[model samples]
Target: MWVCLVVSVALIVARLALRKVRGQKITHGDYWCLCAAVSIVGRLLANHFLLIYGSTRILSAERRIELLKPGFEVQASEIITGSKLVLATRSLLICVLWSLKMAVLDLLARLIMKMPYERKLLYVFWTALFLTYLASIIPVFVGCHPFKKNWQIHPYPGDCVIGNVWLFTYEVSNILTDILLMAVPFSLILSVRIPGMQRLRLLFLFSIGIFLIAVSIMRIVQGHNSRVQSAHTLWASLEILFAVIVAVTPTLYALVRNRHENTTYDKSHLSMGATARTHPGSLAEGDRYAARVWTELNDSASRTDTTSIEGILVERRYETSDVKL
Candidate 1:
C-alpha cells in the first residue's frame, strides 16, 4: 500500500511540475486526467483503509472463514462490495465531468472556426469546464453509498440501488461523449486554410485521439455488469491517461515547434517565412505555414527585451493563420 501510494504521488507531482516548467495551462482533458489520478489515489487509500478496519479487521484466517455461513455467499475477492461501489460511483462522476468538459470544448471549437474569436472561445471553454466541475457532485452523491456491513451481499434481497443507475448512465454517456470529443477537434483542424495534404496530415496526427475513443469503448463494454467489485481500475486508468495525452500532445507539439523555429531563426539570415518549405509526400499547406509562423513566432519570442522587463511585450496568438502553410 505504501509503495503504491508513494509511486502514485510521485507520478502526480512530477506531472504537475513538468506542466509548471512548461507553463502549460490545464485543458479540459487535462482537467479530467488530473481529477482521475487524484481519485485513483484516494480510492486506493480508502480501499486499503477498509481492508484494515472493516469486516476482515485483524481477524485470523480460520476466524474469517468461520464467519462466512451457508447461504451467505462470499463473492470473489475482486467483486465490488458496497465500499467499492461507492468508489465506482465517484469514478463515474469524474467520467461525467469529462463529458461535460468535452461538450464545451467542442462548442468553443465550433465558435472559433466560424467566428475566428479565439480569445472569447478560450474563455467559453474555461467557463464551461468550471461549471462542469461543479455539476460533478450530482453524480457523486447519486451513485455512491456509505459503507455498511451486510448491506447488500445477498442477491435475493436486491439491496443494491445507487450504483446501478450510475453505471448505466456512465457507460452510455461515455460512449457518446468519447465519439464527440474525437470528432469535434477534427472539424477545427480540417477547416484550417492550409493545403489539403498538409491539412490531411495534421488531421491524421490529431486523429490519434480516436485511440482514446477505443479505450472508452472497451471500458463501456466491460462496465455493463454494474458489479463495481469486478470493475478494473487499471483499465480505467489507461483510458484516463490516453485521453489526457490526447489533449496534452497537441499543445506540447506546438510549443516544441515554436521553440525549434525560434532557435533556427536566431542563427540564420533568412526570414521566418523561408523556413516553411515543404518536404515530399507530406500533405497540407498549413504544415508549411505552421512551420513558417512557428519560426517567426519564435523569432518574435527571441526579440523580447529581457533586460527591460517592465516594458516587455508578449504577442501570443492562437489564430489559424498564425499556423502558416
Candidate 2:
C-alpha cells in the first residue's frame, strides 16, 4: 500500500510537469487527478490507523469474545477504533476510484467535444456514472442499521462489519462504469482515420481500464472469501494504483512523442536545405512538391487536433524524399 501511494504521487507530479512542458493549460481532468491524490492520502492514513488498531473484522469469533471479556478494556477500545477505520478506509477508497473516473471522462469529453452524437453519448455516460456512484456510496451509509453498530465491537450484526449487499452493489457499479468509460474513447478512435500506430496507442491506453475491472472483481471475491479487512484494503490500493497509472499514461505518451517530433523536424529542415543546394536543377520542382506536402500535412494535423487525444496524438508528418536531378 505504501508503494502504491508513492507511485501514485509520483505519477501525479509527472502529469503536472508534462502539461507545463507541453504548454497546455491545466484542464478539469487535471483538477480531478489532484482530488484523487488527496483522497489517496486520506485512504493511506486510514489504512495506517487500521494497522495500529487492527481490524475487528479480522478477529475470530473466539478472539472477539476474549477481547470483550472483563479486564480487556484496552483491547476492546482498539477493536472499536479499527472498526471505524474500516469504514473510513472504504469511503476514501471509493472517493479515489471515482475521482479517477471523472478525470478520464473529462478528458474524453474534451477530445470529442465537436461531435454532436458523441457529446450526447457522453451525457448518457455521465448520467449513468452519477447514478452508479450513488448506488455504490449509499450502502456505505445505510447498509448497517443503528449506524453506531458499524463500529460496535461485539454483539453487532455481520452487516455492520462487511455488508454483502454493499459489496455486490459497489462491485457491479464499479465495473459497469469502467466498461462504459472505456467504450466512449474506443468508439471515437474506431470512427476516425488516424495512423495505425496512433490508433494502436490510443486503443492500448484506453484498454488499461480493463485491469481496473479485473481488480474490482478480485476485490469482491476477496471480500467474500476472506475475513481479513487488510486483504480487501490491499486490493483497493492496487485498484487505485492502476487507475492513477492509466490516467497519466496518455499525457506521458504525448510528451515523449512531442519531443521526438521536434527533434525530427529540426533534422529534416537541415536536410531539405542541403538537398536544394546539391540538386539545383530539380530545386524548384522539389520545393513545390515539398511545400504542397507540408501544407497538406499541416492542414490535416490542425483538423485532427480538434478531436485527437489532448490535441497531441494524431499529427500527420511529412516524409522527406531525395530531389530528382
Candidate number with greatest TM-score: 2
TM-score of 1: 0.52
lDDT per residue for candidate 2 within 76-105, as digits (tens), equals 898788878878877887788788888888
Off by over 4 Å in 2: 259-325
- Give one digit per residue, the lDDT tens place, for model 1 in 46-83: 54544433322223355445445564354323222534
Give residue 319's error in model 1 in angstroms.
17
Cα lDDT of all candidates, in order? 0.44, 0.68
Report residue 238 deviation for candidate 1 (angstroms): 2.6
